[model samples]
Target: MDIKLDDLTGSKIAGLINEHLQGMALNSPQESIHALNLEQLRKPEITFWSAWEGNDLLGCGALKELDPYHGEIKSMRTAKEHLRKGVAKKLLQHIVEEAKKRGYQRLSLETGSMDAFEPARKLYASFGFEYCKPFSDYKEDPNSVFMTKELFKK
Candidate 1:
């Protein structure tokens, strides 16, 4: 798979992001939905990426700079047909590598606490992320789960 920075101006990426947000809205309460829309991801603080295989859009994830030393993962989603095919894992690995490249000391993410999010939590766990309190503007919400990982510059 080829991973590259996404400009978020294309119809395909827009559709994917909207789909992700829609999925989040369905599983989490209105107040608990934290997924960003295209305009939000286009912010200068956020770096978005999408994985592709030829013409197929496999998955996508984004990293938001909380500070020079920290980043928050966002917009993580794999295409429905590509689920369980390592698409999201690869995108996540790529996002982490980008964070490390930026000299970030930590990477964090927020996911749903619902059963629909179990696979995502497990994926982060496999990458050594630990459950953590809400970071940034988030607060304690029973519907949300937070995870973080410390990056070792290699």
Candidate 2:
């Protein structure tokens, strides 16, 4: 799949993000739901990307700058047609590479603690992410699972 930097105007990417937010809201508690809407993801501090194969949108992910050396993962989702096809893994690896290129010393993320999120947590773990305490503007919430990975310059 081709990973392309997106300006968040594509309706496919926007729809995927909205789906993620809706899923998060359903399974997570109100206080622990940190999923950003399209408006928030369009902020200058966030860089969004969409994976495509010709006219098809395979998946999308984003990196949110938390500080000079830190970044957070956001809006990761694979299209229904692309599920179980490594689309998410490809998008995640691309985002991690971009984060390292940007000189982020570490990458972090917050995912739901529900069963619906198990696949996501597994994907992150395979990339060497480990569970950690809440970071940035986040506070401890049982419904939220935080993970972080240290980046090595490549």
Candidate 3:
């Protein structure tokens, strides 16, 4: 699969992001939802990417720069037909590699704490992410699970 930097203008990417938002809403309470919308994901601090095979989109993910040394993962979603095919894993690996190349010392993410999110939590843990307190603008929320991995320790 080819993973490329996305500008959030394509219809495929937009639809995938909308689906992600809908999934978040369905699984988490309104007050605990932190998933960003298309416009929000387009912000200058965030770098978005989409994975594709030929013309079909497989999945997408984003990395938001919190500071020179830290970054956050966001909007990780594998297309319905592509679930369990390692699409999320490839997208996640791509994001982590990009963070390392950018000189980030830490990578973090927030996902739901519900059972629906178990696979995601397991995926992150497999990549060395450990449960942590909220980071950036996030506050403690029972509905949210935060994980972080140190890429380069000082």
Candidate order (lDDT): 3, 1, 2
Candidate closest to the true structure, highest TM-score:
3
Instruction: Give a tens-digit lDDT track for model 1, residues 1-154.
Output: 9999989998888889989988998899999999999988899999999999998998899999999999999999998989999998999989989999999999999999999999999999999999999999999999999999999653
Backbone clash pairs for candidate 1 read none
**Backbone clashes per model, in order?**
0, 0, 0
Query: lDDT tens string, model 2, 1-154?
Result: 8999999898888788878888788888778888889899889999999999999999899999999999999989998789999999999999999999999999999998889999999999999999999999898888889999999653
Q: What is the lDDT of residue 65 in candidate 3?
A: 97
Error of 3 at 54 (Å): 1.0
Regions more than 4 Å wrong, model 1: none
- C-alpha lDDT of candidate 3 relative to the true structure: 0.96
Q: Ten-residue segment with the worst summed lDDT in candidate 3?
A: 12-21
Q: Can you write out model 3's per-residue Cα lDDT over 83-123, one digit (the tens) per residue?
A: 99999999999999999999999999999999999999999
Each candidate structure's TM-score, on Cα atoms with residue i matched to residue i, is: 0.97, 0.95, 0.99
Model 2 TM-score is: 0.95
Ranking by TM-score: 3, 1, 2
